[model samples]
Target: MNNMKNMKVPSGGAASTLAKLGIIGGIGLYAAANSLYNVEGGHRAIVFNRLVGVKDKVYPEGTHFVIPWFERPVIYDVRARPHLVESTSGSRDLQMVKNWTSSPYSSFAWPATYSLSDPWREL
Candidate 1:
């Protein structure tokens, strides 16, 4: 009968609804994953926004959260590490002066000392 045919449900409609739900769920999961992150020990992180510049607050070692696609974290190691300071220059005497110094976190350089002197003295 025409009435019975009209009452029948379209099979494709149910499949389409389920497919849409699945896609939405997948997107939600992806966003949630991106919103969370962890900072390891001896490290710090800075929160940043797409529209704003670096935030003033620094996050220590721990778990943190942010809005996906709108914000991000930049991690930095606060631990003391080795660094080399070096330079080369040609003097008025037609002599080449080269010097280099290495230290852990460059202990000598901390509170950085600067002076104008003969570069050859450090060589």
Candidate 2:
């Protein structure tokens, strides 16, 4: 018991310093991860800034970077989709007519005057 009393106790200063450093490192890693975005093939992306509205430029396939929390990337699929349309109606001669159509359609050709505020609504 006498020998135990002679031992010195360690201080908490070193542990507190290490904890502060760990917190800072974790925040830095999180910011870095959130700053990058990827656009896959047949897809596109657009930037929306918090301060301003949507950016005018569209990003193609690949990786791009933006400010974390201040800007966001909105990805869109521009690939063509197949659609089938069928209809049945009476002809000018009072005869029954059946129409069947299959075509490839895509929204990528949307007019330039389209609004950027809510792009998803247009789709």
Candidate 3:
């Protein structure tokens, strides 16, 4: 804990795991490709920092959405990232093309759910 002797935690409950972390760039969520929070029980301090920026990130896996034992649980963005590819070309299935799910034109509908096309728009 000595290393974190000068670290700071959220004051006045401004930081809630249950609450939205922040709105960045636009209305986008505060998503560092990773986050890290160091805790010190003796000093009653929690030092939360983004691992993505750390020089040698201990949390290689990026664990920011953490639920403290006493406080609210940090919320993970289960809302998958979206991509919207616009093309006048023919649909993918017609050409047997496979795009990364992150592709924009990937539609999330009921069709891909109940069948092989669930959540996907195959031409």
After superposition, candidate 2 runs with Cα above 4 Å error: 1-12, 87-95, 105-123
Minimal lDDT window, size 10, model 2: 108-117
Please provide, for model 2 over 27-121, each residue's C-alpha lDDT reduced to its tens digit, 9 standing for 90 to 100: 99999999999999977788988887688787889999999999998887766666767899999999999998766652444323334336743
Question: Candidate 3's error at 13, in angstroms?
Answer: 38
* lDDT values, one for every candidate: 0.73, 0.79, 0.33
Q: Give candidate 2's whole-model lDDT.
A: 0.79
C-alpha positional error of residue 85 in candidate 1 after TM-score superposition, expressed in Å: 11
Model 1 ranges off by over 4 Å: 1-12, 82-123
Clashes of each: 0, 0, 8
- TM-score per candidate, chains pooled: 0.58, 0.65, 0.17
- Model 3 earns a TM-score of 0.17
Most lDDT-accurate candidate: 2
Model 2 quality (TM-score): 0.65
> For model 1, what is the alpha-carbon lDDT of residue 45?
76
Tens digits of per-residue lDDT, candidate 1, 32-76, equal 889999999877777777776556677778999988988888776
Q: Please report the candidate that would top TM-score against the real structure.
A: 2
